[model samples]
Target: LTRYDRMMARRRPKKGQAASKGYREAKKWRAKTYAKIARQRQDTGRKWAKKAVTDHDAIAVEDFRPKFLARSSMARKAADAAIGATKKALVEMGRKHGRDIRLVHPAHTTMDCASCGARTKHALPLSERTYTCTACKVVSPRDKNSARVMLVRAGLNPAGVEGVRPPGALLPEAA
Candidate 1:
Protein backbone atom coordinates (compact mmCIF):
# COMPACT_ATOMS: atom_id res chain seq x y z
CA LEU A 1 0.00 0.00 0.00
CA THR A 2 2.84 2.40 0.78
CA ARG A 3 4.46 1.55 -2.55
CA TYR A 4 1.18 2.13 -4.36
CA ASP A 5 0.80 5.47 -2.59
CA ARG A 6 4.27 6.50 -3.65
CA MET A 7 3.59 5.45 -7.23
CA MET A 8 0.38 7.45 -7.36
CA ALA A 9 2.08 10.47 -5.80
CA ARG A 10 4.85 10.34 -8.37
CA ARG A 11 2.43 10.10 -11.30
CA ARG A 12 2.66 13.09 -13.68
CA PRO A 13 0.36 14.44 -16.38
CA LYS A 14 1.16 13.38 -19.90
CA LYS A 15 2.48 16.10 -22.27
CA GLY A 16 1.60 16.91 -25.94
CA GLN A 17 -1.11 15.64 -28.40
CA ALA A 18 -0.91 12.05 -27.13
CA ALA A 19 -1.57 13.27 -23.59
CA SER A 20 -5.20 12.11 -23.64
CA LYS A 21 -4.17 8.60 -24.68
CA GLY A 22 -1.57 8.53 -21.92
CA TYR A 23 -4.16 9.71 -19.43
CA ARG A 24 -6.54 6.95 -20.44
CA GLU A 25 -3.84 4.35 -20.08
CA ALA A 26 -2.89 5.63 -16.65
CA LYS A 27 -6.54 5.63 -15.54
CA LYS A 28 -7.01 2.07 -16.73
CA TRP A 29 -3.92 0.91 -14.86
CA ARG A 30 -5.02 2.59 -11.65
CA ALA A 31 -8.46 1.03 -11.97
CA LYS A 32 -6.90 -2.38 -12.40
CA THR A 33 -4.73 -1.85 -9.35
CA TYR A 34 -7.71 -0.79 -7.29
CA ALA A 35 -9.68 -3.82 -8.41
CA LYS A 36 -6.86 -6.14 -7.47
CA ILE A 37 -6.46 -4.57 -4.03
CA ALA A 38 -10.22 -4.76 -3.42
CA ARG A 39 -10.24 -8.43 -4.36
CA GLN A 40 -7.42 -9.15 -1.96
CA ARG A 41 -9.21 -7.34 0.86
CA GLN A 42 -12.44 -9.20 0.14
CA ASP A 43 -10.71 -12.54 0.19
CA THR A 44 -9.09 -11.82 3.56
CA GLY A 45 -12.38 -10.61 4.99
CA ARG A 46 -14.16 -13.74 3.87
CA LYS A 47 -11.60 -15.90 5.61
CA TRP A 48 -11.84 -13.95 8.86
CA ALA A 49 -15.63 -13.88 8.73
CA LYS A 50 -15.78 -17.60 8.16
CA LYS A 51 -13.58 -18.22 11.16
CA ALA A 52 -15.59 -15.82 13.37
CA VAL A 53 -18.93 -17.38 12.43
CA THR A 54 -17.61 -20.85 13.12
CA ASP A 55 -16.29 -19.84 16.52
CA HIS A 56 -19.10 -17.59 17.71
CA ASP A 57 -22.82 -18.17 17.79
CA ALA A 58 -23.74 -14.54 17.22
CA ILE A 59 -21.78 -11.63 15.82
CA ALA A 60 -22.51 -7.99 16.51
CA VAL A 61 -20.97 -5.04 14.72
CA GLU A 62 -21.67 -1.38 14.07
CA ASP A 63 -23.48 -0.62 10.82
CA PHE A 64 -21.19 2.08 9.58
CA ARG A 65 -21.75 4.14 6.45
CA PRO A 66 -18.38 4.53 4.76
CA LYS A 67 -19.49 6.84 1.96
CA PHE A 68 -20.10 9.75 4.30
CA LEU A 69 -16.83 9.16 6.13
CA ALA A 70 -14.94 9.04 2.85
CA ARG A 71 -15.80 12.68 2.38
CA SER A 72 -14.03 13.54 5.64
CA SER A 73 -10.28 14.25 5.62
CA MET A 74 -9.38 11.91 8.52
CA ALA A 75 -11.46 8.88 7.46
CA ARG A 76 -9.81 7.79 4.26
CA LYS A 77 -7.77 5.17 6.14
CA ALA A 78 -10.95 3.80 7.67
CA ALA A 79 -12.66 3.73 4.28
CA ASP A 80 -9.78 1.67 2.95
CA ALA A 81 -10.04 -0.89 5.76
CA ALA A 82 -12.84 -2.86 4.01
CA ILE A 83 -15.22 -2.76 6.98
CA GLY A 84 -18.26 -3.03 4.71
CA ALA A 85 -16.73 -5.95 2.88
CA THR A 86 -16.00 -7.68 6.18
CA LYS A 87 -19.56 -7.19 7.40
CA LYS A 88 -21.01 -8.55 4.17
CA ALA A 89 -18.75 -11.57 4.42
CA LEU A 90 -19.73 -12.08 8.05
CA VAL A 91 -23.44 -12.00 7.17
CA GLU A 92 -22.95 -14.59 4.48
CA MET A 93 -20.96 -16.80 6.80
CA GLY A 94 -23.58 -16.43 9.51
CA ARG A 95 -26.28 -17.60 7.11
CA LYS A 96 -24.25 -20.67 6.29
CA HIS A 97 -23.74 -21.38 9.98
CA GLY A 98 -27.33 -20.67 10.94
CA ARG A 99 -26.11 -17.97 13.30
CA ASP A 100 -27.33 -14.43 13.88
CA ILE A 101 -25.48 -11.33 12.72
CA ARG A 102 -26.43 -7.89 14.02
CA LEU A 103 -25.33 -4.41 13.09
CA VAL A 104 -26.08 -1.62 15.55
CA HIS A 105 -26.48 2.01 14.57
CA PRO A 106 -23.26 3.99 14.55
CA ALA A 107 -24.79 7.21 15.86
CA HIS A 108 -23.51 8.38 19.26
CA THR A 109 -21.55 5.18 19.78
CA THR A 110 -18.25 7.00 20.00
CA MET A 111 -19.30 10.22 21.63
CA ASP A 112 -21.38 8.57 24.36
CA CYS A 113 -19.34 7.13 27.18
CA ALA A 114 -20.06 3.52 28.01
CA SER A 115 -19.38 4.04 31.70
CA CYS A 116 -21.18 6.65 33.83
CA GLY A 117 -23.06 7.75 30.68
CA ALA A 118 -21.25 11.05 30.73
CA ARG A 119 -21.53 12.81 27.39
CA THR A 120 -19.11 15.67 27.28
CA LYS A 121 -17.42 17.66 24.54
CA HIS A 122 -14.50 15.24 24.50
CA ALA A 123 -14.49 14.24 20.88
CA LEU A 124 -11.67 11.75 20.46
CA PRO A 125 -8.88 12.46 18.06
CA LEU A 126 -8.54 10.04 15.16
CA SER A 127 -4.95 9.22 16.13
CA GLU A 128 -6.00 8.25 19.65
CA ARG A 129 -6.77 4.54 19.96
CA THR A 130 -7.76 4.43 23.63
CA TYR A 131 -10.99 5.76 25.14
CA THR A 132 -10.60 7.65 28.38
CA CYS A 133 -13.90 8.51 30.02
CA THR A 134 -13.48 11.65 32.02
CA ALA A 135 -16.86 11.46 33.76
CA CYS A 136 -16.61 7.91 35.19
CA LYS A 137 -12.86 7.38 34.98
CA VAL A 138 -13.51 4.17 33.06
CA VAL A 139 -10.81 3.85 30.45
CA SER A 140 -10.80 1.17 27.76
CA PRO A 141 -9.92 0.49 24.18
CA ARG A 142 -11.67 2.86 21.84
CA ASP A 143 -13.21 0.16 19.65
CA LYS A 144 -14.37 -2.03 22.52
CA ASN A 145 -15.94 0.88 24.39
CA SER A 146 -17.64 2.00 21.21
CA ALA A 147 -18.91 -1.53 20.68
CA ARG A 148 -20.38 -1.60 24.16
CA VAL A 149 -22.13 1.68 23.50
CA MET A 150 -23.46 0.21 20.27
CA LEU A 151 -24.82 -2.77 22.15
CA VAL A 152 -26.56 -0.46 24.59
CA ARG A 153 -28.05 1.50 21.71
CA ALA A 154 -29.26 -1.78 20.19
CA GLY A 155 -31.02 -2.64 23.47
CA LEU A 156 -28.96 -5.77 23.98
CA ASN A 157 -28.93 -5.63 27.79
CA PRO A 158 -30.85 -3.28 30.07
CA ALA A 159 -28.32 -0.48 29.81
CA GLY A 160 -29.31 1.78 32.66
CA VAL A 161 -32.66 2.60 31.13
CA GLU A 162 -36.14 1.88 32.48
CA GLY A 163 -35.73 -1.05 34.90
CA VAL A 164 -32.13 -1.17 33.82
CA ARG A 165 -29.04 -0.35 35.86
CA PRO A 166 -29.59 2.42 38.39
CA PRO A 167 -29.91 5.83 36.78
CA GLY A 168 -26.69 7.33 35.40
CA ALA A 169 -25.49 4.29 33.48
CA LEU A 170 -26.79 5.85 30.28
CA LEU A 171 -28.85 8.77 28.99
CA PRO A 172 -25.92 11.08 29.19
CA GLU A 173 -26.97 14.60 28.14
CA ALA A 174 -24.87 14.82 25.02
CA ALA A 175 -24.81 15.82 21.43
Candidate 2:
Protein backbone atom coordinates (compact mmCIF):
# COMPACT_ATOMS: atom_id res chain seq x y z
CA LEU A 1 0.00 0.00 0.00
CA THR A 2 2.79 2.38 0.86
CA ARG A 3 4.50 1.72 -2.45
CA TYR A 4 1.34 2.31 -4.39
CA ASP A 5 0.54 5.33 -2.25
CA ARG A 6 3.85 6.90 -3.09
CA MET A 7 3.30 6.20 -6.75
CA MET A 8 -0.14 7.79 -6.61
CA ALA A 9 1.19 10.83 -4.78
CA ARG A 10 3.83 11.41 -7.39
CA ARG A 11 1.24 11.14 -10.13
CA ARG A 12 -1.47 13.19 -8.46
CA PRO A 13 -2.98 15.98 -10.59
CA LYS A 14 -2.91 19.62 -9.46
CA LYS A 15 -6.12 21.13 -8.06
CA GLY A 16 -8.64 22.26 -10.78
CA GLN A 17 -6.49 20.60 -13.42
CA ALA A 18 -7.41 17.76 -15.74
CA ALA A 19 -6.00 14.43 -14.53
CA SER A 20 -3.51 12.75 -16.84
CA LYS A 21 -3.95 9.12 -17.86
CA GLY A 22 -1.09 8.03 -15.57
CA TYR A 23 -2.66 9.84 -12.64
CA ARG A 24 -6.05 8.18 -13.16
CA GLU A 25 -4.43 4.76 -13.49
CA ALA A 26 -2.42 5.26 -10.34
CA LYS A 27 -5.51 6.37 -8.46
CA LYS A 28 -7.44 3.32 -9.53
CA TRP A 29 -4.55 1.04 -8.69
CA ARG A 30 -4.24 2.51 -5.21
CA ALA A 31 -7.95 2.08 -4.55
CA LYS A 32 -7.93 -1.52 -5.78
CA THR A 33 -4.82 -2.35 -3.76
CA TYR A 34 -6.34 -0.98 -0.56
CA ALA A 35 -9.62 -2.77 -1.22
CA LYS A 36 -7.82 -6.05 -1.79
CA ILE A 37 -5.91 -5.66 1.45
CA ALA A 38 -9.12 -4.97 3.34
CA ARG A 39 -10.85 -8.00 1.83
CA GLN A 40 -7.92 -10.23 2.79
CA ARG A 41 -7.93 -8.91 6.34
CA GLN A 42 -11.65 -9.51 6.69
CA ASP A 43 -11.36 -13.06 5.39
CA THR A 44 -8.65 -13.99 7.85
CA GLY A 45 -10.42 -12.32 10.75
CA ARG A 46 -13.59 -14.28 10.08
CA LYS A 47 -11.76 -17.58 9.77
CA TRP A 48 -9.86 -17.09 13.01
CA ALA A 49 -12.97 -15.92 14.79
CA LYS A 50 -14.84 -19.00 13.70
CA LYS A 51 -12.08 -21.27 14.96
CA ALA A 52 -11.80 -19.43 18.26
CA VAL A 53 -15.51 -19.52 18.95
CA THR A 54 -15.62 -23.18 18.03
CA ASP A 55 -12.81 -24.13 20.37
CA HIS A 56 -13.44 -21.97 23.41
CA ASP A 57 -16.61 -22.33 25.43
CA ALA A 58 -16.00 -19.02 27.12
CA ILE A 59 -13.84 -16.12 25.97
CA ALA A 60 -12.52 -13.00 27.67
CA VAL A 61 -11.97 -10.22 25.18
CA GLU A 62 -9.83 -7.17 25.98
CA ASP A 63 -12.45 -4.83 24.46
CA PHE A 64 -9.65 -2.61 23.18
CA ARG A 65 -10.64 0.49 21.21
CA PRO A 66 -8.02 1.37 18.62
CA LYS A 67 -9.75 4.51 17.27
CA PHE A 68 -7.37 6.78 19.18
CA LEU A 69 -4.42 5.06 17.58
CA ALA A 70 -5.36 6.57 14.20
CA ARG A 71 -3.71 9.87 15.14
CA SER A 72 -0.66 8.29 16.77
CA SER A 73 2.58 6.97 15.28
CA MET A 74 1.29 3.44 15.60
CA ALA A 75 -1.64 4.04 13.27
CA ARG A 76 -0.30 2.07 10.34
CA LYS A 77 0.81 -0.82 12.51
CA ALA A 78 -2.52 -0.88 14.30
CA ALA A 79 -4.41 -0.82 11.03
CA ASP A 80 -2.36 -3.71 9.76
CA ALA A 81 -3.07 -5.56 12.99
CA ALA A 82 -6.84 -4.95 12.45
CA ILE A 83 -7.53 -5.04 16.18
CA GLY A 84 -11.02 -3.62 15.88
CA ALA A 85 -12.11 -5.80 12.97
CA THR A 86 -10.80 -8.97 14.56
CA LYS A 87 -12.58 -8.13 17.80
CA LYS A 88 -15.83 -7.51 16.00
CA ALA A 89 -15.50 -10.77 14.10
CA LEU A 90 -14.82 -12.70 17.29
CA VAL A 91 -17.83 -11.19 19.03
CA GLU A 92 -20.09 -11.90 16.08
CA MET A 93 -18.84 -15.45 15.80
CA GLY A 94 -19.34 -16.07 19.51
CA ARG A 95 -22.86 -14.75 19.34
CA LYS A 96 -23.66 -16.96 16.36
CA HIS A 97 -22.27 -19.98 18.15
CA GLY A 98 -23.92 -19.22 21.48
CA ARG A 99 -20.58 -18.93 23.28
CA ASP A 100 -19.88 -16.72 26.24
CA ILE A 101 -17.75 -13.74 25.30
CA ARG A 102 -16.61 -11.32 27.99
CA LEU A 103 -15.38 -7.87 27.10
CA VAL A 104 -12.89 -6.73 29.73
CA HIS A 105 -12.15 -3.05 29.92
CA PRO A 106 -8.77 -2.02 28.53
CA ALA A 107 -7.89 0.52 31.24
CA HIS A 108 -4.63 -0.25 33.09
CA THR A 109 -4.31 -3.70 31.52
CA THR A 110 -0.67 -2.99 30.82
CA MET A 111 0.29 -1.31 34.09
CA ASP A 112 -1.54 -3.59 36.50
CA CYS A 113 0.24 -6.71 37.69
CA ALA A 114 -1.72 -9.89 36.91
CA SER A 115 -0.35 -11.81 39.87
CA CYS A 116 -0.65 -9.14 42.55
CA GLY A 117 -3.20 -6.71 41.09
CA ALA A 118 -0.76 -3.89 41.83
CA ARG A 119 -0.56 -1.00 39.38
CA THR A 120 2.72 0.70 38.61
CA LYS A 121 2.96 4.31 39.62
CA HIS A 122 3.97 5.21 36.07
CA ALA A 123 2.82 3.69 32.81
CA LEU A 124 5.29 1.38 31.11
CA PRO A 125 6.85 2.68 27.93
CA LEU A 126 5.99 0.86 24.72
CA SER A 127 9.62 -0.12 24.26
CA GLU A 128 9.59 -1.97 27.56
CA ARG A 129 8.48 -5.59 26.99
CA THR A 130 8.79 -6.84 30.55
CA TYR A 131 6.43 -6.26 33.47
CA THR A 132 8.03 -6.36 36.89
CA CYS A 133 5.65 -5.91 39.75
CA THR A 134 7.11 -3.86 42.55
CA ALA A 135 4.67 -5.12 45.14
CA CYS A 136 4.99 -8.87 44.47
CA LYS A 137 8.31 -8.93 42.63
CA VAL A 138 6.78 -11.05 39.87
CA VAL A 139 8.48 -10.67 36.49
CA SER A 140 6.66 -11.56 33.27
CA PRO A 141 6.43 -10.53 29.66
CA ARG A 142 4.24 -7.45 29.29
CA ASP A 143 1.79 -9.13 26.88
CA LYS A 144 1.51 -12.25 29.04
CA ASN A 145 0.81 -10.19 32.12
CA SER A 146 -1.83 -8.14 30.31
CA ALA A 147 -3.55 -11.26 29.02
CA ARG A 148 -3.77 -12.60 32.53
CA VAL A 149 -5.19 -9.31 33.71
CA MET A 150 -7.97 -9.67 31.16
CA LEU A 151 -8.79 -13.13 32.42
CA VAL A 152 -8.85 -11.97 36.01
CA ARG A 153 -11.00 -8.98 35.15
CA ALA A 154 -13.44 -11.38 33.49
CA GLY A 155 -13.39 -13.67 36.56
CA LEU A 156 -11.50 -16.43 34.81
CA ASN A 157 -9.13 -18.80 36.63
CA PRO A 158 -6.34 -18.34 34.05
CA ALA A 159 -5.97 -22.12 33.95
CA GLY A 160 -6.62 -24.45 31.04
CA VAL A 161 -8.02 -27.97 30.78
CA GLU A 162 -4.99 -29.41 32.58
CA GLY A 163 -5.47 -27.21 35.58
CA VAL A 164 -3.90 -29.00 38.55
CA ARG A 165 -3.00 -26.53 41.21
CA PRO A 166 -1.23 -27.82 44.29
CA PRO A 167 -1.88 -26.57 47.80
CA GLY A 168 -0.83 -22.92 48.26
CA ALA A 169 -0.07 -22.50 44.61
CA LEU A 170 0.20 -19.02 43.15
CA LEU A 171 -2.57 -18.67 40.60
CA PRO A 172 -2.27 -16.24 37.73
CA GLU A 173 -5.66 -14.58 38.42
CA ALA A 174 -5.83 -15.07 42.16
CA ALA A 175 -5.62 -11.34 42.60
Candidate 3:
Protein backbone atom coordinates (compact mmCIF):
# COMPACT_ATOMS: atom_id res chain seq x y z
CA LEU A 1 0.00 0.00 0.00
CA THR A 2 2.83 2.39 0.77
CA ARG A 3 4.46 1.59 -2.54
CA TYR A 4 1.20 2.16 -4.38
CA ASP A 5 0.69 5.47 -2.56
CA ARG A 6 4.16 6.65 -3.57
CA MET A 7 3.63 5.58 -7.18
CA MET A 8 0.29 7.40 -7.33
CA ALA A 9 1.72 10.56 -5.75
CA ARG A 10 4.17 10.96 -8.61
CA ARG A 11 1.51 10.31 -11.23
CA ARG A 12 -1.05 12.60 -9.55
CA PRO A 13 -1.65 15.98 -11.13
CA LYS A 14 0.20 19.13 -10.08
CA LYS A 15 -1.57 22.24 -8.71
CA GLY A 16 -4.74 23.21 -10.64
CA GLN A 17 -4.53 19.96 -12.67
CA ALA A 18 -7.04 17.08 -12.63
CA ALA A 19 -5.94 13.70 -11.21
CA SER A 20 -4.91 11.08 -13.76
CA LYS A 21 -7.02 7.94 -14.30
CA GLY A 22 -4.30 5.71 -12.80
CA TYR A 23 -4.08 7.89 -9.67
CA ARG A 24 -7.86 7.69 -9.23
CA GLU A 25 -7.76 3.92 -9.61
CA ALA A 26 -4.97 3.65 -7.07
CA LYS A 27 -6.91 5.78 -4.59
CA LYS A 28 -9.95 3.58 -5.04
CA TRP A 29 -7.91 0.47 -4.47
CA ARG A 30 -6.42 1.91 -1.30
CA ALA A 31 -9.86 2.74 0.11
CA LYS A 32 -11.16 -0.72 -0.75
CA THR A 33 -8.16 -2.42 0.87
CA TYR A 34 -8.50 -0.29 4.01
CA ALA A 35 -12.18 -1.15 4.32
CA LYS A 36 -11.45 -4.84 3.76
CA ILE A 37 -8.82 -4.92 6.50
CA ALA A 38 -11.15 -3.07 8.92
CA ARG A 39 -13.93 -5.56 8.29
CA GLN A 40 -11.58 -8.49 8.72
CA ARG A 41 -10.30 -7.15 12.02
CA GLN A 42 -13.81 -6.53 13.33
CA ASP A 43 -14.92 -10.04 12.33
CA THR A 44 -11.91 -11.65 13.98
CA GLY A 45 -12.24 -9.60 17.14
CA ARG A 46 -15.94 -10.42 17.50
CA LYS A 47 -15.36 -14.14 16.86
CA TRP A 48 -12.61 -14.42 19.49
CA ALA A 49 -14.62 -12.38 22.00
CA LYS A 50 -17.69 -14.57 21.47
CA LYS A 51 -15.67 -17.73 21.95
CA ALA A 52 -14.09 -16.42 25.16
CA VAL A 53 -17.48 -15.40 26.55
CA THR A 54 -18.89 -18.82 25.69
CA ASP A 55 -16.01 -20.72 27.29
CA HIS A 56 -15.61 -18.76 30.51
CA ASP A 57 -18.11 -17.69 33.17
CA ALA A 58 -15.96 -14.68 33.94
CA ILE A 59 -13.19 -12.78 32.13
CA ALA A 60 -10.56 -10.56 33.69
CA VAL A 61 -8.50 -8.25 31.51
CA GLU A 62 -6.14 -5.37 31.97
CA ASP A 63 -7.63 -1.96 31.32
CA PHE A 64 -5.00 -1.02 28.79
CA ARG A 65 -4.67 2.37 27.12
CA PRO A 66 -3.85 1.44 23.57
CA LYS A 67 -3.46 5.06 22.41
CA PHE A 68 -0.65 5.60 24.91
CA LEU A 69 1.06 2.41 23.81
CA ALA A 70 0.62 3.40 20.17
CA ARG A 71 2.58 6.59 20.80
CA SER A 72 5.72 4.44 21.12
CA SER A 73 7.61 2.56 18.39
CA MET A 74 4.97 -0.16 18.39
CA ALA A 75 2.28 2.16 17.03
CA ARG A 76 1.68 0.30 13.79
CA LYS A 77 1.57 -3.14 15.39
CA ALA A 78 -0.70 -1.96 18.22
CA ALA A 79 -3.09 -0.30 15.78
CA ASP A 80 -3.18 -3.42 13.63
CA ALA A 81 -3.93 -5.62 16.63
CA ALA A 82 -7.09 -3.53 17.37
CA ILE A 83 -6.98 -4.26 21.10
CA GLY A 84 -9.65 -1.63 21.83
CA ALA A 85 -12.04 -3.22 19.36
CA THR A 86 -11.45 -6.62 20.87
CA LYS A 87 -12.16 -5.27 24.34
CA LYS A 88 -15.35 -3.67 23.13
CA ALA A 89 -16.46 -6.92 21.57
CA LEU A 90 -15.64 -8.82 24.72
CA VAL A 91 -17.66 -6.42 26.86
CA GLU A 92 -20.60 -6.69 24.50
CA MET A 93 -20.44 -10.48 24.50
CA GLY A 94 -20.16 -10.57 28.27
CA ARG A 95 -23.29 -8.44 28.65
CA LYS A 96 -25.18 -10.65 26.22
CA HIS A 97 -24.18 -13.84 28.05
CA GLY A 98 -24.51 -12.43 31.60
CA ARG A 99 -20.83 -13.16 32.23
CA ASP A 100 -18.50 -11.07 34.33
CA ILE A 101 -15.91 -9.00 32.47
CA ARG A 102 -13.58 -7.21 34.81
CA LEU A 103 -11.03 -4.69 33.60
CA VAL A 104 -8.40 -4.17 36.27
CA HIS A 105 -5.62 -1.62 36.36
CA PRO A 106 -2.60 -3.01 34.45
CA ALA A 107 0.05 -1.30 36.56
CA HIS A 108 2.57 -3.61 38.24
CA THR A 109 0.65 -6.71 37.21
CA THR A 110 3.55 -7.93 35.11
CA MET A 111 6.47 -6.81 37.26
CA ASP A 112 5.02 -7.95 40.61
CA CYS A 113 5.59 -11.50 41.84
CA ALA A 114 2.31 -13.37 41.75
CA SER A 115 3.20 -15.75 44.57
CA CYS A 116 4.84 -13.40 47.08
CA GLY A 117 3.15 -10.12 46.04
CA ALA A 118 6.50 -8.39 45.76
CA ARG A 119 7.18 -5.84 43.04
CA THR A 120 10.48 -6.11 41.19
CA LYS A 121 12.75 -3.11 41.72
CA HIS A 122 14.07 -3.10 38.16
CA ALA A 123 11.84 -3.03 35.14
CA LEU A 124 11.57 -6.27 33.18
CA PRO A 125 12.22 -5.69 29.52
CA LEU A 126 10.27 -7.50 26.80
CA SER A 127 13.34 -9.59 26.02
CA GLU A 128 12.98 -11.24 29.43
CA ARG A 129 10.28 -13.89 28.91
CA THR A 130 10.44 -15.24 32.46
CA TYR A 131 9.86 -13.46 35.76
CA THR A 132 12.08 -14.39 38.70
CA CYS A 133 11.08 -13.03 42.05
CA THR A 134 14.08 -11.53 43.84
CA ALA A 135 12.55 -11.89 47.31
CA CYS A 136 11.11 -15.42 47.09
CA LYS A 137 13.31 -17.00 44.36
CA VAL A 138 10.17 -18.12 42.57
CA VAL A 139 10.24 -18.29 38.76
CA SER A 140 7.21 -17.94 36.49
CA PRO A 141 6.43 -17.42 32.83
CA ARG A 142 5.98 -13.71 32.20
CA ASP A 143 2.52 -13.83 30.59
CA LYS A 144 1.15 -16.41 33.00
CA ASN A 145 2.33 -14.43 36.01
CA SER A 146 0.61 -11.29 34.76
CA ALA A 147 -2.59 -13.23 34.12
CA ARG A 148 -2.52 -14.66 37.63
CA VAL A 149 -2.07 -11.19 39.04
CA MET A 150 -5.08 -9.95 37.09
CA LEU A 151 -7.14 -12.89 38.29
CA VAL A 152 -6.13 -12.16 41.87
CA ARG A 153 -6.95 -8.48 41.50
CA ALA A 154 -10.37 -9.45 40.21
CA GLY A 155 -10.92 -11.46 43.43
CA LEU A 156 -11.23 -14.69 41.49
CA ASN A 157 -8.66 -16.31 43.78
CA PRO A 158 -8.51 -14.67 47.20
CA ALA A 159 -5.96 -17.21 48.47
CA GLY A 160 -3.30 -15.98 46.00
CA VAL A 161 -2.42 -19.56 45.15
CA GLU A 162 -0.14 -20.30 42.23
CA GLY A 163 0.02 -23.33 39.94
CA VAL A 164 -2.69 -25.20 41.91
CA ARG A 165 -4.64 -26.36 38.91
CA PRO A 166 -4.88 -30.13 38.33
CA PRO A 167 -3.16 -31.63 35.32
CA GLY A 168 -5.07 -31.16 32.07
CA ALA A 169 -7.38 -28.81 33.93
CA LEU A 170 -8.29 -26.84 30.78
CA LEU A 171 -8.65 -29.83 28.50
CA PRO A 172 -12.11 -30.44 27.01
CA GLU A 173 -12.14 -34.02 28.27
CA ALA A 174 -11.55 -32.77 31.82
CA ALA A 175 -14.78 -30.79 31.59
Best model number under lDDT: 2
Who is ahead in TM-score, 1 or 3? Answer: 3
lDDT of each: 0.70, 0.84, 0.81
Q: Write the per-residue lDDT of candidate 1 for residues 15-58, one digit (tens) a residue.
A: 55343554555666778887897898899889999877766565
Clashing pairs in 1: none
lDDT of 2 at 150: 90
Q: What TM-score would you give candidate 2 relative to the actual structure?
A: 0.76
Question: Which ranges of candidate 1 are over 4 A from the true structure?
Answer: 1-28, 68-81, 127-130, 158-175
Which lDDT value does model 3 have at 153? 82
TM-scores for candidates 1 onward, in order: 0.63, 0.76, 0.76
Which regions of candidate 3 are displaced past 4 Å? 12-16, 68-75, 78-80, 158-175
Q: In candidate 2, what are the lDDT values of residues 8-69, reduced to their tens digit?
A: 78888899989989888888888998788778888889998987787678789888776555
